[model samples]
Target: MFANALVSFEQMVSSYPGPLMLVTILCPDPHFKKRHHKRRVVQKPLVDSILKNLHPGGQVFLQSDVLEVALDMRNQFDSHFDVLEHITDIDPSVLCDNEGWLLINPMGVRTEREIHAEFEGAKVYRRMYQRRI
Candidate 1:
């Protein structure tokens, strides 16, 4: 794993000549403090680089327990990429009638953090966006 996504993005993309089919960012550190916000993983430059390397119709999956962080990711994708759809496999009632965010885990595989969050009874928001020329 790269220590810094922004710094390593160029090299990572160049190393793989073939178009990337999918990129997943799950439960990233929110860096809640305003002063540390810059350290957050999902930023414009990284998002732009991901879009640049992603193949057309390829999808990007993002999930976070923090609603603010999840919405920030959605805004980034909406601004830079064409959002094809939002994937969910959960009951509407469980989400408390919130239609703005995804309720289910799109990626079948769950990260350790996600599993723990669920055990703690935390709400996890997810979003899936497609890159289109």
Candidate 2:
């Protein structure tokens, strides 16, 4: 993934788009263990490049089911950008659809792990945050 990003970065720079809005999502499985957190997608280099590319008011969103990853992301982002909203704090009204409908993603569209967890009746946690404009 990192190699792919490096290649993409090179391509983007060569093409020179108007601006970039990058979102880095990280969710390391439990088996990844403490030392392997470095393997996760969200890291200092990625964040720095993203910030450099993003135009003023451009936002970045990240999500993770792992508590530690979420917390670490929160801390890292807080240092560089103001927190616009946290998923836990979002008002239900803001999450509604264009027709003022509340939407829920059904299990049918879930990832393999999500499907397994649903069958096992396990609870899943999610966090969302956006970078400052």
Candidate 3:
């Protein structure tokens, strides 16, 4: 996960050269104020960088509990990309079967932080978009 707010995402475009891949972006913490430039990561330029880096037919997966941040992300991607799926549209029965489905982690394990967040009753909102070919 790239933590730098001014990351040059375009530099990583070649990491995947094929179609139908996944790119996950975890936005900066939502509690940051507008004046805190050091912590904000979801700016317009960064979004553009991400779009440029993504391959055609690739999926960009974004997760955040902050409503405002989510809206901003949706707006930015909507203007230049196509949304392929929303978490709610998935079949409920397939959720439990998703364990170990991801390619990067053979075990497909959830991070300890995620488990703690779930137990803490935090709302986790997930959304996915595709790069327009």
Candidate 4:
């Protein structure tokens, strides 16, 4: 694993030669202090890079145990409503509710932190977005 933001998300994403089909920003850094907010992983540069390099119909999966961070991430990605559709907004199955929050992780696989967080009675906020075709 990379150490201490040794490589930014933008740089890592750019290293790929082709557009990406899926991107997961899971259990991201939660800089709780207001002064440390600048160090947070979910920032504009990363978002721009993802949007530019992601293929049409590509999926972006985001999750965190911190509610504030999760909401911030959701707002950042959902801000680009023209290009990105929140899974709940566009899922054809009509399983998503109008409330905008998801009850569980959509990805079949679960990270250890996610599993443990839930087991400890903490909520894991999850959101999925798709690049519009």
Candidate 5:
């Protein structure tokens, strides 16, 4: 069933029967306006909830066409979770460094928005993390 992820993510995580193996958040609204930035979806509370619900080795994949928003997502994960290095077969140049900021799309599969952005020559940032034991 559909649920408001922002409000129900924690509950869903808690009630889930088994460990969540993978979580992907793609193209979250940037909320560009300074006044609306606070309303962005990727925040400390949600990150915390994800961490708590994640299995020790579960993976979290996040991507955004907006560099600033991607960086914010990285910051949120860095603060709460031990960011993981890129494990894809893609070019190493696209992988995240010690700071966990990916310069390319590691998933290989592009979202519709991502494809459109790429067609317009937009830069997308991505990050991946694994829950530590």
Candidate 6:
């Protein structure tokens, strides 16, 4: 698997054999400093690439141990909802709760970071964006 931080996600999306049905970004580095924020993996170019290449009914799954990062990622996708008709349309009963946090891990598996975060009593934030038909 390619490392999200070091890899050009746009190029990865472009070179894939077929439309991506699912894209999962789990616990991306927050890059807390304002100047370093540019290194975030959820930038517009990557978002655009996913939007352009994701097949209809595809989904993007995002989660982070840090609330700020999670919200930032969510907002990035939120801003694109207007143009994509993907974020706003969803089967929420299967995806998330009323407050927009996914109640269950859609992947059905937890990463070591997730388990560690939970064990340490840190809150995890999650959201899903699904393309509309």
Best by TM-score: 4
In order, candidate lDDTs are 0.76, 0.51, 0.54, 0.83, 0.76, 0.80
lDDT of 2 by residue, 25-108 (tens): 534454357787776566677667776766654555543445466567657665773534433234453353442222332112
Clashes of 1: 0
Q: What is candidate 3's local distance difference test score?
A: 0.54
Ranking by lDDT: 4, 6, 5, 1, 3, 2
Off by over 4 Å in 3: 1-5, 14-20, 82-109
Candidate 6 residues 1-133, lDDT tens each? 5556335677776788987899889999899999999998888878888888888888888999898899899889888775444343455357556667877787899989999999999878888778776
Error of 6 at 66 (Å): 0.6
For 13-89, candidate 5 gives per-residue lDDT tens digits of 88889888788899988999999988888877887788777787778889888988988887777676244433442
In model 1, the Cα lDDT at residue 31 comes to 89
Clashing pairs in 2: none
TM-score of each: 0.83, 0.55, 0.63, 0.87, 0.81, 0.86
Candidate 5 global TM-score:
0.81
Model 3 Cα lDDT, one tens digit per residue, 81-113: 343443323433323123212112222454554
Considering TM-score, which of the candidate structures 2 and 4 is the better prediction for this target?
4
The digit string of per-residue lDDT tens for model 4 on 5-119 reads: 4246667767878779998888888899999988888888778888988999999999999989998899999899899988877876534444566767788899998988989
Reference-based lDDT, residue 7, model 2: 34
Predicted structure with the largest lDDT when compared to the true one: 4
Model 4, global lDDT: 0.83
Off by over 4 Å in 1: 81-97
